[model samples]
Target: MTKEQIIFLHIPKTAGTTLREIVYAQYAVDRITPIYRDERFMDMETFSQLPPEKKDAADIFIGHFAYGFHQHLSGNRPYKYATMLRHPIARGLSLYNHLKNLQFAGSEISFSELLKNKGSQFRNNQSRYIAGWGTQKMLETAIQNIEKDFLFVGITERFNESLLLASHDLGWQLKPYKRRNVTSTMWATNYADQLRNDKESMQELQKLNTIDMQLYEYANKRFSQQIASHFPNAVEKLLHFENRLHQAA
Candidate 1:
């Protein structure tokens, strides 16, 4: 093994936990899972928060925050950076249902109310971290800040394909597919009744989820170009993985 490490920048509700599990299994390396108790750093503005010795120790760092790995990247430390994203509408709905579960258990706000005021109460992962509210600023930020050398940027809609691309990059033959965030899926299905019953609520949800709708549209359009840039043989690799799975079945 060449001993190069991969940094997985996990975006919330994007099947990231499942991806991390697969990566951990395939690579046989400890994965960085974000829990406040774990010693992994979350502070993005401060470099010193992540101790140099700790940075040198890990073969893979996977978490729900952004740090450019300056020490590793600038110094030829043999690190590859990758991130994953979900369609905005799907991600927003996932967040809503998650919070709505709390409402059911006796939070003051109703699911309908939350949908109406989504811009304030709910933070899209981008809004929560990188940019502010549902503004064009997010698009601008993404365009400006995106790495030209992102090893792989996984799209949640085509997750299996994304994994094959990442596996190929890591020189692994394993395939990752179908596993999803169980909690998120359950919450959505559980709350489907609320959505079905309230027409006004659904309309509010559409307004609140405008950012996600836009995100899905934008990502779907740009995905092909993104794949071509890094994974020249990505289509063939995905087809190969599909064939293997079918043969196994």
Candidate 2:
């Protein structure tokens, strides 16, 4: 069997940090290329420029890049793509908290003010990231890409099931790992209550992330169908995996 090359499109704030730990446990560190960190490396173009030996040596390509990175591979190695999706409203809030906590761009503004001031990139970010643009056609393209290109698209809300399904398909022994990169602000801690108390803000957030909301709904439906069709024993397996993880902990 030709070994499969896995491309993990690690969308920001989607439990990607924990997923990376699981991946690192399964694959040798040198075989995994962390492309998200270096802004100099423009996904496919930079990957294409790598020497053939380096290209063949890497087993996984992971980062915040979009869907088309696999097209840049030089060899005949078959690749499978995987990603996790989050509810757009929650993701947006998490992103805002992350930036605020880190004192990054837009950290000084209130969430409402930030929404008003930030670019479209901050709005329907998941859709923009997946489709590589923020057009209606691009949204359709993103859905098509998920349908055709991805081997497994997981939901961040269903982290354990997602991990178990990916491990089963990829033949990896991925145990549950510690979560990382969590938002650490008091506001973030009470985000759910804040949203509950501020109906207008929640509505505004939904309105702003219309594209992402649609995309997330689509991905979520497909994720459920995938579990039902491909991983019938997923619940049992997930339970077992959790039990094992707890025992280890």
Evaluate all candidate structures by whole-model CA lDDT and list the values in order. Answer: 0.58, 0.75
Worst 10 residues of 2 by lDDT: 184-193
Model 1 per-residue lDDT tens digits across residues 1-249: 226666667766678878767766765553342322245644443423555656655666676555344443334357766667776655656666666675444566766566465545444454333332244566555534444434656688887766665665555556534575655556535554555466776666567556545655665566667667767887787788788767866
In candidate 2, stretches whose alpha carbon ends up further than 4 angstroms from where it belongs are: 38-48, 104-108, 116-118, 134-136, 184-196
For each candidate, what TM-score against the reference?
0.69, 0.85
Clashes of each: 1, 0
**Among all candidates shown, the one with the greatest TM-score:** 2
Q: What is the C-alpha RMSD of each candidate to the true structure, in Å?
A: 4.8, 3.2
| Candidate 2 local lDDT, residue 120 | 61
> 127-204, model 2: which lDDT tens digit per residue?
776776435666788888876777777899988878766765667775758777766443434344455467787787
Model 1: how far is 192 from its true place, Å? 4.1
Give the clashing residue pairs of candidate 1, or none: 88-212
